[model samples]
Target: MEELLRFGIVGCGSVAAFHAQAIENTSGAVLTACCSGNPQKARTFAAAHGARAFDTLEELLAGPVDAVCLCTPSGLHARQALEAMAAGKHVVVEKPMSLTLEDADRVLAAARQTGRKVCVISQLRFQPAVQAVRQALDAGAFGRLVCANLSMNYYRSEAYYQAGGWRGTWAMDGGGALMNQGIHGVDLLRWLMGPVTSIRASVLTRAHAIEVEDTAAALLEFENGAVGTLTGSTACHPGYPRRLEICGTEGSIVLVEDALVRWDLPIPCPVPVGEGANSGAADPNAIGAAGHTLQIANFVDAVRNGTPLLVDAQQGRQALEVVLGVYASGRTGRTWHPETP
Candidate 1:
């Protein structure tokens, strides 16, 4: 029998619950430890999850866990991930791995140096609908992809930003809606559509009185000559489901909230039939734990056997680059191309 993989969670926040639940659901994985900035909260979380609580990440790393899930603020991912890797532990870091490309690269470097596997949380890819789309794309079902668009209209009140002191700040939450909320779509888009060559964008803090943008739009040019648009806003009232539209010479696909709503293709590709995945359109906590569960299962398998991750540290950096590209274009009011590393 395979040895059980022990897991640790850092930063016991709203999202950490999802990680803990996912670990509980995955086979051959157990949550053994957790840490949080708030000692009492950590103790409470530990008691609820049947795990040990630590006052610091260092203490958690010194424990018996073989992996660490970083559910911390966006800004803390890179540093904490590096520390975990340095301690010979695998890492499952939350989205937008780091605020800067340099830091993302640093994390990647640490992963290589430490020979530790680093998985980034991009649970959307594990959706059955997304898998079907990817399979069709791979089989040339989407002939010569022409255009793709992503729309994320989410609503987070001013109180939401105020509740989390780092929510709207560039230092912690990174960019506002696009980085914090829209990155999942961004990564999914880039993964499906291919490498983006150039981008022109505009960002604004139209609704909230925050340091970062609540509304943003961008025009993208892909390496395959596909043109696309990306729009995200936390200010949009009566928040609507996030949508992704991918078009090609053969046909097009429209996915809303990770469900294949429309599938028009020349070939007979299996239509994904199921209930739509939960969306955090109006409330961040509305998202379900299924995707997280699948991802944690994959991470456990990857650690136990030598399987490759669906979203590795490098892919995480690619997503971060696209996000930074949007921010750069928003700042200069000109087209920006991702810098080659």
Candidate 2:
């Protein structure tokens, strides 16, 4: 039998628990060690998952581990990933990979220089609905795509921002709702559609009194001449379901509750991607955790079998560029191009 991959987690916070549980559940993988600034939290997290806990990343890296998952704050990802790569471990980082493109590029360069695999945690790519859309698009079902719409409305209380030191800060969390909350939807938008060519956007902190915008909207133009709109907010009370709609000359499809709850194609199809297929049920609270677990499994499989990662670090950077473009466009009051800087 192949050896079980040993995993180390750096940052034992709320998300870390999900990663720990996922690692514990996945076969051919084991949660060997964990690191966190708070020794108590680390110990609690590790004990619950049947893993050793360390007070610092340095100590964890020195132990036996094949990969390290960086669930640290957004701004800290680049540095932590570099440290892990330097320690001769493959890395998986939570998204918005870095605060700036320069940092994202730096981490990628380090991974290449050190000959380590680095993956960005964009778990939405693992969703059944998303896979269906990708397959349909690839099979020319969405012939000549014309428009796409992405909207994520979720409430974030003031306490949510105050829960951690890095929650609502621009330098740390990158942006507000767009960066921290809605980035998955933003990534899914770009992934199913194509690369964004240009964007005109507007952002503001309308709802909560936070440092970053709680509300944001943007107009997007794709390289393939398709136009789209993205609106995200944590301000809306009794928020609506996160929805994505892709329309083309051929037909359209809609995904609700992270499942292909609605799909209308021009013709009937075989095994409508993940239909009746069990990836398990959708749990909003565990969505990120589920995505993270699937992502981890894929990364480990890729390393062991030489398969491709669902969302590589490079793709993560590209997704970040789209979000940044929206912020930049909103700030400058002009269309921003992802290709530029």
lDDT of each: 0.92, 0.83
Instruction: Summarize candidate 2's per-residue lDDT along 1-341 as a digit string, tens digits.
Output: 99999999999877777777778767788999998878998889888888898888999999989999888888899998988899999998888789899999999899789988889887878866677779989999888999999988777777778878888898789898889888888889988898899999999899787788999999999998999999988887756667788999988987764677556786664334333322212223545466667888898898898889888888998888998998999899999986655
Per-residue lDDT of candidate 1, residues 185-303 (tens digit) = 99999999889999999999899999999999999999989999999999999798899999999999899987988889776647665447488999989898999999999998888
> Candidate 1, 23: how far from true, in Å?
0.4
TM-score, one value per model: 0.98, 0.94
Q: Which prediction has the highest TM-score against the true structure? A: 1
lDDT of 2 at 94: 82
Supply the TM-score for candidate 2.
0.94
When summed lDDT is taken over every stretch of 10 residues in candidate 2, the lowest stretch is 274-283
Which residue pairs clash within candidate 2?
none
In angstroms, give how far residue 289 of model 2 lies from its true place.
Answer: 3.9
Please give the distance, in angstroms, between residue 142's alpha carbon in candidate 2 and its true position after superposition.
1.4
